[model samples]
Target chain A: METLFYIAAAVTLLATLRVITHVHAVHALLYLVVALIALSLIFYLLGAEFAAALEIIIYGGAIMVLFIFVVMLLGPLAVEQERTWLTPGAWVGPSILALVLLGEVGYLIVAGDLPAISIQEPRQKAVSIALFGPYIIGVELASMLLLPGLIGAYHLGRRLSSEAR
Target chain B: MSLQDLIVLTPILNLGIFCLVTMLAIAFRRNHARIAAFAFVACLLTLATLPWVASATPRAVTALLIVDRYALLYMGIVLCTTMMVIGLSYHYLHIQFRERDGIEEYYLLLLLATFGGLVLTVSVHFVSFFLGLELLGLSLCSLIGYVRTRRHPMEAAVKYLLLSISASAILLFGMALLYFESGSMTFRGVGMVVKQVQAVPGLWLGGVVLVFIGIALKLGLAPFHMWIPDVYQGAPAPITAYIATVSKGALVALLLRFVTDIGALELPSLVHLFSLLAVVSMVVGNVLALFQQNVKRLLAYSSIAHLGYLLVALLAGGPTAAEAVTFYVIVYCAMTLGSFGVVTAYSREAGDAEQFEDYRGLFWTRPWLAAMLALSLLSLAGIPVTAGFIGKFYAIAAGVDAGLWWLVLALIGNSVVSLYYYLRLVVTLFGDKPASATTPQGLAIESPQTSGWMAICSLGLVASIILIIGIYPEPLMELIRTSVSNLLMVAQQKP
Candidate 1:
């Protein structure tokens, strides 16, 4: 189980790095989706299935789709001017930061006591209760937050269609 | 829920209902554009009820939100600012949309955003906190691009949308990590677990850093502040006012709650991180603002610097810090709203009065408007006999009490640097005359007959109140002290 966690974490970290460095927005978003899914799997392994589901739905599904839609809407012809990597100074800081973070996490994995993972335990029910019982207001608030975005999208699409006419 | 819960939550509910009613009215009414005026009146009425309701009952609603004096005070500030924004929106939206398109959606978004801010002020749990932040953020994205016909507005919206998503994702990831480490998601639950758990080598630090980045992004701090200028410049004046005031205000309120509820001050690394952010934000924001020619972009950078000052108070981390932060935010809301109001009031029909050159000779044409604009700019610069001065004083004092002498000095230095650009606008208003007296093409060229005395008087009243508060600050200081005491008491009380 611990080895699986390490593998998943490594995959996520590498994928996330690719997401940033990739020149194509669609490709970057795909990498992001992959990394997000992997991270969610790791969350489930850590006994947080609820967070894992939220990660899949919110980040992987809704947000990534939004990114892709926007990219498509902008069209590939509108790609920003590319700047070549000219200096090594830029890479040095990020590289050092990444190395330090990896080292710290590696130490924790080796030194800290591990919790056992149970595959069959019912964790979804707990999350549901938390969401609906004490967290009902939060769920409602999230819906309200999405309301304006929906209206804005509608308005944008309508204006575009009308202009095209 | 009891009467106290209802009382404390009435403003939020009222605003929410206003949003729904506005939407429905738009669906049914042909003259939906005029609903904003009604919405503005409704907001003012709602604000009037807040003091009565909050004082009548101050307690937590469902244990998730606290209805204390602090929350009520900020609620009043948010509501009043929203009202001013609505007034500003009337002229700006009318000009932008003309009679061809409906603008009821803008009012709906504004009300929702204000509601989110109200929730953020009172939220005691992570659930409400994240909800409020996102609601506030998503609405702002729409507001930023409300004038979708334009290139800059669309670009600004896209930039804000992309960066905001990244920030929210990081925030969610941090919340997940913290929950996993502590086996709890609520603020109190996290506090309890943090108290019991021994140090985890990487997770704790990474979680803390991620959370800090999230807050810093929302606050538009130095390193993470790339979206500020573009968004501010692209958005319509009224929406910009909303972003500058309510959106940032909510984020600060959430940051305050998160730090206090989670006992963040107990963590040395977090304190160091915040101090570092404060220093960078102060230095970078002021330096950047000095070079901006666009009034919108300048104010955006100024907003970033003002948030830095608030951070100084936040990092102080006690009752004094709370009082100073609350007071500073209140003053910030007033100054930002008034400044944006002036911009909205004076801008051309095409929103073309954005450049510094356009403001030349504004005083000669519109003396009262120019005076109010100058007042707001002076307050933002922290000049004596203005609310900004008192707020800055409180921040410096709080920083000193926290033994952060260097931060206080940095703040003072930045305050001095800020005065140059702020005064530039003031000087331009009175000193510089336009090259030609002829009308500039594309400028909104409002006739003297169209200048609404009611709007000017309302803004003048706000400017005067700011001055009154700045000169005789004891009453507001005492109110802030009570609010701070309540917040600290609640923070210390065990759930």
Candidate 2:
């Protein structure tokens, strides 16, 4: 099980690197989706099934799809016409930061001091209860926040249709 | 059912009812501007209810939110700023849209965002904080692109969306790590874990750093401030005002509450990190502002510097520091609203007259608008006889009390650098210009003839309050002392 965890982590890291280096926006997004899915699978192996599920559902499925849709809508032609690489300074700074983080994570795993995964039955019911009980007000507040976005989108559609005339 | 509960939720209820009534008015009437005016009036009434509702007795409505004087004061600031922004929006959107199709939606978003900000000020759990922050963020994206007809607005919205998504993801990941380590999600629960746990290890520190990064991105501090200039320049003036005043104010309130409740002052490492960020933001923000030709971008960088100053008070980490931070937020909100109001009024007719040169001879042509703009700029530059000066003095005093001499020196240096650009705008407004040049394209050089009675009145009222507060700050100081005292008491309460 530990060996499998290491392999999955290695695969996730490789996929993330590819996502960053890919020239095409669509390719980058696809690589990101794969990296995220692999990362979630690793989480599942670590006994966080609920978190893994959310990772796949929200990040891999919903958010990645949004990115792909945007890229496609903007078209591959636009991507090809635009600059492929960001500023060298941007690449260098983030790379250095990422390396520092990677070193820290590596030190923890190597020291054998990382907390052992305590596999308990996933508390799916408890999570939902918490969401709807003490967290009900926050859920409602989030919905209110989204109300504006929905209204704004509707208004945009109406304006576009009228302008089509 | 309890008085404390009612006291905590009155402003939120007011906002809900305001949004509903405004929607009904919009459905019945074709006049977009009138609906906006009604909404503004509603916000004013809501602001009036806050002082009466704030309790001396602290209470929590649930495990999630605390009702105290601290939250009440911040809510009042949010509502008051929203009132001014709504009044400005009525004229600003009308001039931009020409034919109003969905102007009512803008007010709805503003109210919702204000509600979110109020929630953030009182939140005691990560769950509530995330919800509030996202609500504030999502509404802002829409508001930034409120003028969909323009290319720059759409571009700005897209940039804001992408960056905010990344920030939220980082924030969530940090929350996950924190929950895993502490075995809890509530602030108090985490504080207990921090106290009992023997060794924190690297993952814990990483999570804390990621959380700070996410917050820094939202605050538009240096290193994470790339989005501010573009978004501020592209968005409609009223929306920009909302982003500057309410959004940033709410974040400060939340940070203060989180630190106080979680006993972050005990952590020397965290204090060091915040102090470093404060110094960097002050120097970088001021230097960037000195070179900006666009007025909106200038203010954006200035805001970054202002946030650094607020951080000085926050890092001071005493009851006095908390009082100073609250007082500074109130004064900052008033000054920013008035400045943005001037921009909205003049620029609506001048078609995004944000360029420094666009304001040449403004004092000769439109003395009232120019004068208000001058006063606001002076206030922002920390001139004597303005609220900005009093706020800065308080912040410096708090920093001195905390022995943050280095931060005080950095803040003073930045204030000096900021004065040059702020006065440039003032000089341009009163300077002489050639009379033969045709108006620049996309520049709204000519002031509109319409009677902007309400907008002007709101600006005048806020400016006068700023002046009064600057001259005699004892009243506001006392109020702030009461609020901070109440906050500390609630924070010390055992769960």
Q: Write the per-residue lDDT of candidate 2 for residues B159-198, one digit (tens) a residue.
A: 8998899889998998788788777777777666667766
The segments of candidate 1 whose C-alpha lies over 4 angstroms from its true place after superposition are A1-116, A119-124, A160-164, B1-4, B193-202, B437-454
Q: Chain A of candidate 1 scores what in TM-score?
A: 0.56
Q: Which whole-number lDDT from 0 to 100 does residue A84 have in model 2?
A: 47
Among incorrect, acceptable, medium and high, the docking class of model 1 is: acceptable
Model 1 agreement with the true structure over B278-329: per-residue lDDT tens digits: 8899899999999999999999999989999999999898889998999999
Best by lDDT: 2
Model 1 residue B459 CA deviation in Å: 1.9
The DockQ of each candidate is: 0.31, 0.34
- Supply candidate 2's per-residue lDDT for A25: 62
Per-residue C-alpha lDDT of model 1 across residues A1-165, encoded as one tens digit per residue: 687687678868987898789776655665677678778778867877677788989998986678657656666543541122323533443355345445545654797754478554447787688777767778778878778878777766565432555
User: Model 1 TM-score?
Assistant: 0.84
Residue B347, model 2, lDDT: 71
